[model samples]
Target: MANTMWRRGVEWLAAAAADPRACKWEWDHGEGIALLEAGRFWDVLTVPDRLGLLALDLLWRPGLPVPGPTLVDTAAGRVGFFLPPDPSGGWVGSGLRYAAKGSWVAVPPPYRSARFLEWLIPPDGNGVLHPPGPLEKALREAHGALAVLAPMCGR
Candidate 1:
């Protein structure tokens, strides 16, 4: 079931990229997961809103935790992982913010390490967020695949 949904996500992304009028999108390659953002509301709305894209399950994966209180801004067409609060005023942990405008940012260390830095990419191809155990290798593969597929999609 999960695999089916995942594959559908990949297919939808590919179709969106193939359409010349499809809005631009990007993703961040970070510690826990890959965060994706589509520049226009329609592009992103087609996924979570209309298609009901499921959240990637990461419970069994060690060193990679599912982000808490994830927020998707349907209006701004942005998605972000918010850091939980601590006893102190400061954020207890780090989080990620991906804007459809092609900007990705992550809260720096103490909150999290440099590994959490976001990697931006066009919204095409397969965008899988492999767990932390094999993050580096997975990212390389995903990025390479996206690069090859992006041009064909008119990205």
Candidate 2:
């Protein structure tokens, strides 16, 4: 059952690529990572690791809805959150970068972590995504938390 779910998840993720079959083939053939186009199935909102981690914690707390797929680029110190495509530019500010329309995100296979890329929250193959309302709230809370801590750390 787990394997089937994972396969479905992989398939779902690959659908974001320009060529789904080729993308899946790359993953199956031991490719560490592949760049998948954004703004199709979903868009990506990227933030600094510190801020993103804090928001992730808040989002996953008891009774809150689980967030969609999240990716971390360790080498780049950034985290990407998958959200429904919002072409009206609603995802600007708070040091967040919106990857919509023409952007691409590096994705590793759902079952494994690539060298500098890892899944902070992996997709479940059910096509769920992070809703904008709660996501913005979580990010604001995270920002406030960091603001409080920054002074103590002299940062």
Candidate 3:
């Protein structure tokens, strides 16, 4: 159920990106990632921002109202959107577990706004992002990049 919701959200974001006025997408090399910020939440591009990357840490308190995405400092530098654990208790949690690849920290409140969600895309060995097989693959690859950023969860 949650997966479906997540995927649908991604589709919607992608559609929004397709919409000329929805989101402004750009790639940042200094940050070693791609970013997409929309004026509203639930935008499809926000899906990658939420699922593709990892927070510097996972200090988010469960059951707390996120209001929106959160930003945190990370070994990779700064990552946005520290998604909370999915209520489904499925691969979502395990998929987001701290890996040696990236740092995991809390997303500060001031940064927790609808416009703040940004996707982090890792570059390949050639320092280029390779398109993955599917949306899930793209998202996982983004997460893998996050692992490369921190490589160790401070927590």
lDDT of 2 by residue, 1-155 (tens): 87987888898899898888888887778666889988888999999999999999899888878888899999999989999988875877867899998988889988889889999888889999998888899999999999999999999
Instruction: For each of the candidates, give the backbone clash count.
Output: 0, 0, 16
* Model with the higher lDDT, candidate 2 or 3: 2
Instruction: State the RMSD for candidate 2.
Output: 1.2
The best candidate in terms of TM-score: 2
Model 2 C-alpha lDDT versus the unseen true structure: 0.88
- Relative to the true structure, how large is the alpha-carbon lDDT of every model? 0.31, 0.88, 0.31
1-155 per-residue lDDT for model 3 (tens digits): 54554444344433323342222122111222223332332212122233433321222235432223333334433443322222332324342432111222221112112233233321111212111123234456556666666546541
TM-score of each model, in listed order: 0.24, 0.94, 0.26
Candidate 1: clashing pairs of residues: none
Estimate, for each residue in 51-149, the C-alpha lDDT of model 1 and write its tens digit.
Answer: 111222222246664323223335434343322211232212122222333433222211112342321221122343323233223334444565687
Residue 4, model 3: Cα distance from true site in angstroms: 1.0
Better of 2 and 3 by TM-score: 2
Candidate 2 — which residues are off by over 4 angstroms? Answer: none
